[model samples]
Target: MGYETAKDLTAGTCGGIAQVLVGQPFDIVKVRMQTSPSGTYSGMLDCAGGILKNEGPLAFYKASRSSGTLTPLLGIGLCVSIQFAGLEYSKRVFSSRNVASGTGDGSLTGSQFFASGVIAGLANSVVSGPVEHIRIRLQTQPDKARLYAGPWDAFKKIYRANGIAGIYKGQVATLCREASGYGVYFWTYEKLMEREMTQKGIRRDQVNPAKTALFGAASGYTLWAVIYPIDMIKSRMQTDGFSPATGQKYKSTWDCVRTIWRAEGIKAFTRGLTPTLIRSPFANGATFLGFEMAMRVLNAA
Candidate 1:
C-alpha cells in the first residue's frame, strides 16, 4: 500500500479511539487486578468471581462504560497521532541514514524500530496520561455511587485536588509505558505478520481477514508478554503515587519490581494475566480489524 502520512494519521486516530471505547472496561478490570495484587483476588478468574458474587456481573464491568465513553475519545488522538508520526519519523530516519544499503536488512533495524515505538508511545502518553488518570480513578472507584457522576465530575475533582497536574498524575511513567509498550507492540506485530505471510506464500496485501485478526491477537499477546511487568509498575506508580525525586514510591522500575518481589513475590507481576489473556486477544483483534476497515472505508469515501 502507498504510505500517505495524513491518511495514516487519520486512520490511527480513529482506530485507537474506537478500540479503547470497546475495551476500556476490560482495561479498568485489568488495572485493578494489576494494582491490587495482594487483595482478595488471586487471579483474574478469582477477581472476576468476587466482582460477580458481591457486586454482580454488571459490577464486574463497573465504571468502564462511563470511563470508556470519555477515555477513548481522548485515547484515540494519542494512539493514532503517535503511531502515524512515529512511522513517518522512522521513514525519514531510514532515508537519511540509508541504513539499509549495506546491511541489506530491507527494513528498519530492531533499535530503529524500538525508537519509533518510543516516539509513538510518547505521543500517546501526552494525551493518555490525563485521560488515563481519569479513567483509572473512575473505573476503580470505591463503589458505583462513588464513581464520578460523570466525566465532568471526575475532571473537576482532579483539577480541584491537584491542579492541572492532578489530571495527569503519573504522566512520566505513563509516557515510558505507552512509548515502550506500543513501540514493541507495533514492531513485533508487523514483523510477525510479515514473516507469517512470507512463510505461507501469501501476498502481504492479500492476507485473509481471519488470519489477519489472529495475527493481531498474537501481536497483543506478544506485546503484553514483553511489557506486562513494566505495565505492572506503571499501574502502581499511577494509582498509588510515586516520588520521582527519591524514587521513594516505586523507585526505578527495577526497584519497583524488587519491592514487589519482596512484598508480593513473583506472582505479583502477573496478577491479572488471566482475564487479560482471555480478553486482550479478542479486543486487540477487533481493534486492529476495526481500525483497518475504518481507514479503508474513510479512504474510499
Candidate 2:
C-alpha cells in the first residue's frame, strides 16, 4: 500500500504536470474566456481559432504552464486530503450508523462525498488562494507588457500596494469556487460509481482501480459542466484588479458578475467549457489515482 501511494503520487504529479504543459494552450484560451467574457471571441471554439490564427498554436497556451510547477504538487496534497481524509470521515460516520442498524452502505455516499469535498475544498482554497491569484494575474496579462515584473514582482507589487490583503484579493471568490467545484466533483463521482455498481450487481468495495479512475473522471467533468459559468465569474472577479497607478476598481464580486452578465449575456459563462471539460476529467482521474495509490502504499508501510 505504501509503495502504491508513493508510486501514484510520483506518477500522478509527473502526469499532471505533463498534461498541464501539453494542454496549457487550451488552458490559456479557457482562462481568457473565463476572465474576459466580453472582451472578444465568439465562443470557446472560436476563441481557440482566433488564438491559433493570430498567435499560432503555441500562443494558445499562456505563460502559466512554465510557471505552474507548484500547482500539481498542490494537487497531490489536495487529492490525498480530499479522497483519503474524506473517506475516513465518511467511513466513521457511516460505520457508527451501521453499528446501530447492522445495515448501511459502507462506501461513502453522494452526501458523504459532498461533505468530504467541502472539507477538501476549504483546505485547498486556503493554500491555493495566493498562488492562484498570482497565476491568474500572470496568465491574463502579458510578460513584456506587464504589471509586476514576474511572479515575485506580482507578489511584491500587490503586497506593497494593497498589503497582505491585496495578495488575497479575491479569497472569498476562490473559496466559493473550490467549495462548489470540489463538492460537486466528489459527490457526482461517488454517485456515478454507486449507480454503476448497482447496474453491474457488484458491491461498491468490488470496484477496481480503472473503474475508480473513470468514476473520478466522470465526476470531474460533471462538476465543470455545472459550474463553469460561476467559475468564469470567480476568475474574472479575482483577476481584474488594477495596479496602484491605474487606480482601476472592481465594485464587488456581485458587481463584477453583474457587469459581465449585462455586457455578455448567458453564453459568456460557458466560454472555457470546452477545454476545461477535456482537462478536468483527465486531471481529476490522475489526482484520484495518485492519492489512492499513495495511501495504499503508506498504509502497507
Candidate 3:
C-alpha cells in the first residue's frame, strides 16, 4: 500500500551512482575474466593485477579517448529503477490478496517477497539486456583493432548486423540471472534487515545508511551465489562475437552452459569470483544505502 513509483525511481537513480562508483574497477576485471578465452589468467587476482600493470589504472574503468570514467552508469540506474519498480508494483498487487504468502496484513511473507523480486528481475532484464550488451562488447574488446569504435559505434554495428535482436544478445541468460538471483538477493537482505530492525528497535528510516549498505552488500552476495554460473553464460554470449577462438559461438544459452561445463568442469562456473566478491559488497552496499535514504525522503514528501 505504501510503495510509490516516484519513490522507487528516485531511490534507484540515486542508488545507481554508488553502485557504479564502488564497483566499476572490480567489474572490469570480472568482465575480462568471464569473456576471456579458456586458459587466459591464472585467477581473478592475476587478471586484475595484470590489467593494472599493463594497461594502467584507467583500464579498470573501460575508458579511452572517447569513453569516460562513467562505465555503464546509465545501465545500472535503469536496471535498478526498473527492478525496484517491478518489485514494489508486484508487492502492491499481492498486498491485498491473501494468497500463498501473508494474510494481506500489508507485510509480505518470504515467498511473496521472493516472487516480487523475481518479477522485478524480469522487468529489469528488458532494459538491462541491451544496456549490458553494448557495455560488454566494448569492454571485452581490446583498444586497438576493436570491432566497434565506441558504445555508439557498437550500437550501430550490432543494429546493422541483426537489428533489435542483435542488440539483445543474452536476454535469456539475463532473465534467468535476474529472476533467481534477485529473488534470493532481496529476500536475504530484506529478511536480515527486518531482523536487525526488530532486534535493534529501529524504524526503516532509523536503519541508517551504514546498516542499509551492509544489507545491500549481503543482498549482492546472495544473488551472485545463485547467479554466477548463469551470469558467466550471459557474459560469454554477449562477448562471443569477435573472439578468434574456435567453437566460441554458442547456439543457445543451454548450449553455452553445457559446453562450458563439459569442457572446463565446475570451476568454469566461478572463473572470476574473486573480483566479483570484492566488488559486490561495496557496490551493493552503497547502492542500497543510497536507495533507502532517497526513498525515505521521497516517500515522506
Q: Higher-TM-score candidate among 2 and 3?
A: 3
Q: Per-residue lDDT tens digits of candidate 1, residues 120-171?
A: 6777677767766766666666664574765668889668756886677666
lDDT of 2 by residue, 1-301 (tens): 4543345345445434444544556667788778763657777778778767765655554454354445433543444443345444544666577667766645555676788677666766665677667767877775446775557777888888789877887777778877887788767766877787889898655667788778878877877776677677767766776553554346677877787678778777677788887776676676565555554555556
Candidate 1's TM-score: 0.78
lDDT of each: 0.67, 0.65, 0.82
With candidate 1 superimposed using the best TM-score fit, by how many Å does residue 100's alpha carbon deviate from the native? 11
Residue 42 in model 1: lDDT? 62
Clashes of each: 3, 11, 0
lDDT tens string, model 3, 1-301? 3447867876888888778888888988898998887799998878988888988887887634357565477778878878877887888787767544555557678998899999989888898898888888777777666777777888888888678878988889998888999999888877888898889998888886787888898889898989998998899898775333433478888988888888888988888888999899999998888888888888678
The window of 10 residues in a row where model 1 has the poorest summed lDDT is 239-248
User: Residue 20 lDDT in model 2?
Assistant: 54
Rank list by lDDT: 3, 1, 2
TM-score of every candidate relative to the true structure: 0.78, 0.76, 0.91
